[model samples]
Target chain A: DVKVTQSSRYLVKRTGEKVFLECVQDMDHENMFWYRQDPGLGLRLIYFSYDVKMKEKGDIPEGYSVSREKKERFSLILESASTNQTSMYLCASSLIGGDAYEQYFGPGTRLTVT
Target chain B: TQLLEQSPQFLSIQEGENLTVYCNSSSVFSSLQWYRQEPGEGPVLLVTVVTGGEVKKLKRLTFQFGDARKDSSLHITAAQPGDTGLYLCAGGVLMNYGGSQGNLIFGKGTKLSVKP
Candidate 1:
């Protein structure tokens, strides 16, 4: 089974503080993604990495950044925590190729900005 | 402008009941995947339909991709309390410029509750 692990299950940060969410996958998948889930908004992609040192912005990337320095780890950074940035953050990984269509997700991190 | 739309937003049913959820999109997708998310956990992939007019079944769950590749449906037979969760439908498309290989457009999700 593919295992995707996130650093924190719950987090709280003050306004204007920097926040980092870490994710690691044991499957060595080539594609990793970060998304924020909000009520009525669904899961909107924040950033994604296809390979080491390669990052791409998703639909909602304004308040977020990503890092992929290694094959198994992906990190999402919130420049300045705000009440609007509080959400359930999810990390997912998938292999490369047709069979990689399915993504395995972590247990998620619920971030609260105050 | 939600690219993917799923309905009904919430459903509550008794155990042994059957239910079907629909996902609609205006744009065609290369493939659509179904996921079930339990409370406090991220979504888990249940099935993926790549070919148009294709149907795949996992135990009591049945998934179908529309002929136009713009829509899909999930049918759960003899629903059990263990089936309660938020069902999400996602469409994957290859990127043209982004370094990412693919991006997924997801629906708001249908929250299902099965009571025994």
Candidate 2:
């Protein structure tokens, strides 16, 4: 079975603070993604990485950045956290070819900004 | 932009009832996927339909993709409390830009509650 793990299951941060969410996948998938889910908004993509050092912005990438220094790890960074940034963050990975569309998601991290 | 619209945002029913959720879109999709997310957990892939007018069954759950590949449906038979969750439909599109190989457009989701 494929396993995707996040660095934190729940996190609390103050406004204007920097925040980092880490994700690691055991499967050697080539594509990794970051998404923030909200009520009535569904899962909106934040950023995605196709390979090491390659990053792409998704539909909603404002105030967020990503890092993919290695194939197994992907990180989401918030320059300065705001109350509006509080959300459930999910990380997913998939293989390159025919299976690329079938993403395996990690347990989400619920971030609270106060 | 590709968008998926899910109907009946919320549903509440007693056990042993039958229910169906619909996902509609105006744009064609290369493939469609269904996922179920329990409270406080991430969405899990339930099934994926690639061909048009395809039907796949998993236990008591049945999934169908429309002939035009622009819509899909999920039907649960004799629903149980264990089937309570948020159902999400996503459409896949091949991307030529954005360093990403492909992208998925997700629906707002249908939250279902089955009472025992």
Candidate 3:
């Protein structure tokens, strides 16, 4: 099975703290994404990278940033954590392009900012 | 600006019951996809419908895309406890994947609970 591995399944951070969430996929996919899932807001894209050293903001990229320094690894960074930023964070990867390729997702990292 | 809406945000039913979930959008898409997400896990791809008025089936699940390519539906027959999860629908537009997850737009999702 294609595995998308998240470094942490649960995390807790204090306000104003910098946090990092890591995601790694073994499928050798070229595309990686970061999204935050909330109660009614659903899954909102935070950032994504199609290739190494490439990144783009999604619908809700205001409070977040991303880094894709390697092909198999993607990271989501919270510059300054806040209470409102508490939610479930998901990482997903897919093939390059042409049609919306099916995405394989990591187990997700649930973060709680206090 | 492209948003997909899923109806019946929450549904609770008994096993062996049938249900239908709707995914609607104002803008036409090239293709649509359905996914099911379980607690603590990422969403799993179920089916993708491309052509307008197309229908695809996976066992007890049936998926249909509207002729206009702006909407889709998923019907489940004899839903089991394993069927309990959040169902999400996404649509693809003119080759713009914006940056993340290959540019997929997700619906808010329908949370279904099946009782034994």
Q: Score the docking of each candidate (DockQ).
A: 0.59, 0.63, 0.59
- Rank by lDDT, highest first: 2, 1, 3
- For candidate 2, give the lDDT of residue A58: 94
Instruction: Give lDDT for model 1.
Output: 0.92
For model 1, residues A9-95, the per-residue Cα lDDT tens digits are 999999999999999999979989999999888998899888899898888899889999999999999988899999999999998
Every candidate's lDDT = 0.92, 0.94, 0.90
In model 2 chain B, the worst 10-residue window by lDDT is B95-104
The candidate with the higher lDDT, 2 or 3, is 2
Candidate No. with top DockQ: 2
Query: What tens digits encode model 2's per-residue C-alpha lDDT throughout A9-105?
Result: 9999999999999999999999899999999899999999878998999999999999999999999999999999999999999877575388889
What C-alpha lDDT, on a 0 to 100 scale, does residue A76 get in candidate 1? 97
List the candidate 1 regions with Cα displacement exceeding 4 Å: B97-100
Question: What is the Cα root-mean-square deviation between model 3 and the actual structure?
Answer: 2.1
Per-residue accuracy of model 1 over B1-116 as CA lDDT, tens digit each: 43989999999999999999999999998899999999899999999899999999999999999999999999999999999999999998877644435667899999999999
Ranking by DockQ: 2, 3, 1
TM-score of chain A taken by itself, candidate 2: 0.98
Docking class of 3: medium
